[model samples]
Target: MPSEPAPPSSSLAERVARLEARQEIEELKYRYLRACDHKDPEAFRACFIREGADIDYGELGTFATVDDLVTLFERIALARHNEGHLVLDMHHGVHPEITFLSSTEATGRWTLRFRQLNLAEETERVLCGDYDDRYVVEDGAWRLAKHHFRSLWSLTRPLPKGYVVDEGAHL
Candidate 1:
């Protein structure tokens, strides 16, 4: 017999602030993926807080500070680089669900499609996982407060010899 009242509209300023926060977080995620793929430890480290950061890459070991991750990345990625072996990787993130818990805190979930080609091992690995992340404002900028990834499935295969992908092939 009666209808509920419609919800009030958010103010223009509030809406803009929310959008800005989301955009900042999206950029942070993008930078992280790019840094990882390019093996740029400095860029990767910049995406997170320097102190009191929790990074659990799931079997890669957890680190309390961003410096720890950078150290590991350099040890692993640099060693491969120095040996003249290629380690190409790509990280595609989709289906982002970011929630702003407060002006200074937020949480996010994302689906990650990761591909890696290890020339030294002559193998390629494809992985799919979800990233659960936390963000906080430190020094008036949004930074990754905590980051974790849980793999859903993965595949490792040897690349066929003399295999070449034709760039001209199209639908």
Candidate 2:
């Protein structure tokens, strides 16, 4: 049986719903940038769908599910506190171009520009990259289904060239 087409008004409502969902997805992306740069793995995990969130960090390829991402984040937490000698305080700014593919699904391409500071090495990489993401609505909230990071241009400078590194600096 052929289904009746949606009413004009219903179509408009659907458009509005998709727009609102896109906004929510964009906010989730922003939080991901903030939490990841801060190395707050717990906060980062909260943005995932809880079932099949995939994080592909370019070289790492792809993680199977959100549980796998959690395992990856556990490693990050341990390393940030134990493994790596380099200390970092970074600020990441995300500007995303978001598209709503459906009321439940969307995609985003985000540009990331960041400033990094290493208290131990006195080095910084002013880095830039693109993040392609897929977001979905689950259990009344938007969560990342998949994320891929592709770095474009990365430049390093000697601590901003004459900028003194104070003790316990936060980029």
Candidate 3:
């Protein structure tokens, strides 16, 4: 029987392609944050694996798949709809320090800030946090594999009397 053929080594062109793609992923990460602040699911969805991904929220532990994340968001969005608690409601920001782990993987730490009004609690909150994320290149796209969110600080207080929520405050 003939011996099996040897596998081809990674060519220079292949390496260059991988590097270029990784850089593109980094750019996508920044776009993702802005898109999220805009509350555009179409944009947000582009940043994640959308299936078989894991998310860890520290004390809340980890969710095994992207579907879980979607489910939670659905609940939040639905509740917010009734109370007009839409995010992108206030100034929200994410600053990323993304690093390449390999041609197909990377990790990043992000600083995040957002405001939320919890009508059920009759309180408004400003949350500041850091997110540690793992990214994977799958099928030529970068997707979040494990996302860990930790709140570093939070300020909560009552909404001022006669203070009306404005959806365009940040826009």
Q: Each prediction's Cα lDDT score?
A: 0.81, 0.69, 0.66
Give per-residue lDDT, candidate 1, residue 119.
Answer: 72
TM-score comparison, 1 vs 2, better candidate: 1
Error of 1 at 128 (Å): 0.3
Q: Which model is ahead, 1 or 3, in terms of lDDT?
A: 1
Please give the TM-score that candidate 1 achieves against the real structure.
0.86
* Backbone clashes in model 2, listed as residue pairs: none
TM-score per prediction, in order, is 0.86, 0.72, 0.70
User: In candidate 3, how many Å is residue 139 off?
Assistant: 2.1
lDDT of 2 by residue, 1-171 (tens): 101233467676676666676667777877877776666777788898888676787754578876677677556433442344245545464666777666677788888786666645667877788888888888888888878888787777666556654424341
- After TM-score superposition, the amount by which residue 25's alpha carbon in candidate 3 deviates from its true location, in angstroms, is 3.4
lDDT of 1 by residue, 85-130 (tens): 3567789999888887877888999999999777768789999999
Give the Å error, residue 27, model 1: 0.5
lDDT of 2 at 88: 54
Write down the RMSD of all candidates, one decimal each. Answer: 6.2, 6.1, 8.3
Q: What is the lDDT of residue 168 in candidate 3?
A: 61
